[model samples]
Target: MKKRYLVSALLLFSVLSLFIGVTDLTPLDLFSLTEDQAHILWVSRVPRLVSILIAGASISICGLIMQQLTRNKFVSPTTAGTMDSARLGVLVSLMIFTSASPLQKMSIAFLFALLGTFIFMKILDRIKFKDVIFVPLVGLMFGNIISSIATFFAYKNDLIQNMSSWMQGDFSMIMSGRYELMYISIPIMILAYVFANKFTIAGMGEDFSKSLGLNYKTVVNIGLVIVAFVTSSVVLTVGMIPFLGLIIPNIVSIYQGDHLKKNLPHTALLGALFVLFCDIIGRIVIFPYELSISLTVGVIGSGIFVYLLLRSKLGSKSNAS
Candidate 1:
């Protein structure tokens, strides 16, 4: 019941996004689009909408899988250092493959992202604490170490301006040619769907999964690969849109429980909706002048993060009492 309502709300917001941009595009403009109007609709509005939807859904679902595999609700690409590692790879590309194409940069970013996420999982293996909250803190510290290194190099090369642009998430520049790299996430999302059961079982812990004859390590490696690929693609193309991953999955799980298969679609839907809502708000908040999606999501997501923290604390107290 809740899922249906959320899905409906998402659809409504998506339609609203099409009509509410700075350009005076009405419902009539969509139907009887002149060549110039068609160009605006195709080159600007449609692609932007698609990018937001893909970016939102892919990151959220990736985060959901990460949390499940680690048995930690707080784990995500942003929290777990996967994104920072990928950014490091991007920085390396800028340093070494200075003239490389975006595709080439994406390849390096994917490699580093995989390496970073693998290292994070290894760190998880070493950690004695099984508390969900503590795990992401460790990941954040780990990510900060890599970020500091990236910042050092970026500053040295006078690439801080370029790097800063990449770090901040903005959807306003998403025209037709620029945003197509995000299509890579579609196949990766499909792969995640295909491996959904394996991920769910693997999340139960290595010993339990192995007892059931599942190759736990292999399943985990596969999940990590998907996460790295998706994170790199989104981050490289759209910049870092934080908390889409953390918030969407957590919300879905609240109503749908932790069953990966059941919650996956809802996570994707809510992610798209959340990003759309934020993007629309960013567009209209200052009218013609727009806020970046990252800033909008950051402010809103941080507030939600605080609320969730309080709710979790209260729930713990209630349970104890």
Candidate 2:
């Protein structure tokens, strides 16, 4: 994947996305725009496009960071209970702080997500075997436990409907004011880039990093903070986009190698491209009625994940032979 190819594809999809909707707007409408058409373009489509781009890119990079820090290809916010914890935080906010603003809710979600991620890492430290497949299975179980707790609370509070909304990732409701919190990811992305080298060093191993005078704990903490904050913001704004973080980086790593700085740009581009492609499919598949982004991505990403597992198994057998 060349940068130019990804950029070109992204632009083409973005233009197409701008023109897609129940309300008819076309390429020609750009030149001779009616008030209604212009409003629709500015208010709904553009913001949705922005949200998709930010959420996709941010989550993918967060996955890359996690995989690096944990040295597990499958580790991600989706697998590691970060999103579940954030959802629990959302439920908590609704239950305890009923009138909390979106930012406040996200703040609470961030704390829970951060805590969940830390706990998962501690679990990793205690595990004896640490098989590639086994690690993520544990994460999946951990996440399910957190999700069940959230669901139980939702049922008790009669907020199950509200909880279900955040469970499914959708872009249909995105508009200018509603999607701005995702902009927080931009600065976080920049921070990830700046600390990319340190993260790479930390990923090598804590002993190796300390041998090189790098503060392994600090870099790892920064990486988790970046992951947690971005995950919470995206979950609150766009809902839980599973596997965006898990698969994109692995795909990039297959072609590009594992160096964090080297793979960052490619990971971000492919993440956005994959999400844009999925969003397009969701919109057109039902014509007027759209499927949620979560459904489309989950269906496709899970297939890719299976393929990766099979490939890993085959490679291991070949090496043994």
Candidate 3:
């Protein structure tokens, strides 16, 4: 999609989001704001909008980076065990450091996410077949194993109720104090942009990278670090938004080509636009009650994922024939 069109849509939705909720607030009320309306606008709706945009854009870009580094369309935080490991990290924080602050919890989660993503990449290296369809399935299985461990520990420690919060993405509780940690992703995103070409080169594979005098291992580590940090931040702030990092980049790649730098803007915009659209649907569909962001994104993203899989399968068949 055109950048102008995406920008316009994003702005329109942002305005609509600010005015939407159980409380009666609108553009006209901006001038004659009641105390309650002002509180709602500043305290709740604005933060939720900001979180949605950041989480969506960042996670989507994280997905793009992983796909590039691993040379697989379907590999993402959801598929690669990054988010699950982050959740496990969160569990670790809760169990071991019961009184840990949010930032500390996020730190712990980031470490585990980094380790988990590294392991997945190692597993990717050993796989003999490396089929497109099979790769993410392997990741899914790996993630489930981590998740199962987290669940087992959560149950044993009587933290299952606490752990459930991070299992699904929700924006209902986001507010000024609660959502600040997500700003960590802003700098991370900029860092990703700076290294975009390096990532693209690394994506070409180690032999090609070394032929061009690139430090293949360092670049790959940097890319993995970026993915892990973003995944942990979003998972900590918003919860596990499955299929986001997987699908958005794939969609962008279809129209924008495989150039990482060129596609960054579109991926970020499209990701934000998608999450905003889903958030709007969740708010209005149940009218007052709301669906979690994970539920809406999962339902929609899974459908898109299936379409991509089928498209890839058909393309491969046609090429063979």
Candidate 4:
């Protein structure tokens, strides 16, 4: 849980990621790399590594912010319909802008993501039965509806093949020209860190924040926007990573407490490290083949999520008894 340890692990995994591809570019080859090795290192491997780091950190932070704003340990972009809405937006672009560039596609995706997230929050406001677990369950249902609509239209328009890519996250396809869009998350994450304290205060409740002269709605809207933007950019670029955001921030809070500002860096580091570790395992699992980032993260994250669920339920039962 120490910052130094997380930093060390992230660096080590990042280094290993650089050299552990189908291509034979070990540390030994770094000294006298052939042109093809250098090209692969620069073009494919490094870009994949960079996208993993940024995407991991950004999404984890996005989840942390969402959890804070909603005052729920389980709320995250994946659970909150944010990513699903973005996927629908991407499907729309594919059907409409048959030759759209990545940026243009992301722009449309971002708007829909933001809208879907806003609607989810509004529904949360209207709902009176907000058990800690109930909120994200609602979000999951909301996401499924959006996903179903996307699938229906995709099937009719014959864009299901294009729509399928963003359904799961993968880093293998990220080359230099292909992955630059992921960098958009970097600044958005920095902005999250900058407003961390305000978010923390805002999380206390709209009334509490307003009593302190903070514009509670403004802060919450900003948080939603950041979540949507990061979610859309990551989905458009690398596809939907399962629960990287959901589990990482909760794991961090168990040891680090609930201070959003204090936990930002650690959350970011561990997220990046966790993703890198999963990615390395995915690459080497089949020796010459790969497992894709979404699959690896999904298996491991789902296990952790189950643990979190059981812990919460048992804790509640103990308190009641």
Please give each candidate's TM-score: 0.97, 0.99, 0.99, 0.98
- lDDT by residue for model 4 (200-282), tens: 99999998999999999999999999999999999999999988889999999999999999999999999999999999999
Cα lDDT tens digits for candidate 1, 81-114: 9999988999999999999898899999999999
Better of 3 and 4 by lDDT: 3
Candidate 3 lDDT tens digits, 1-321: 789999999999999999889999979999999999989999999999999999989999999999999999989999999999999999999999999999999999999999999999999999999999899999999999999999999999999998999998999999989999999999999999999999999999999999999999999999999998988888888899988999999999998899999999899999999999999998999988999999999999989999999999999999999
62 in model 2: Cα distance from truth in Å? 0.4
lDDT of each: 0.90, 0.95, 0.94, 0.93
Better of 2 and 4 by lDDT: 2
- Output the TM-score of candidate 1: 0.97
To one decimal, what is the Cα RMSD in angstroms of model 4 from the true structure? Answer: 0.9
lDDT of model number 4: 0.93
TM-score for candidate 2, residues paired by index: 0.99
Worst 10 residues of 3 by lDDT: 228-237
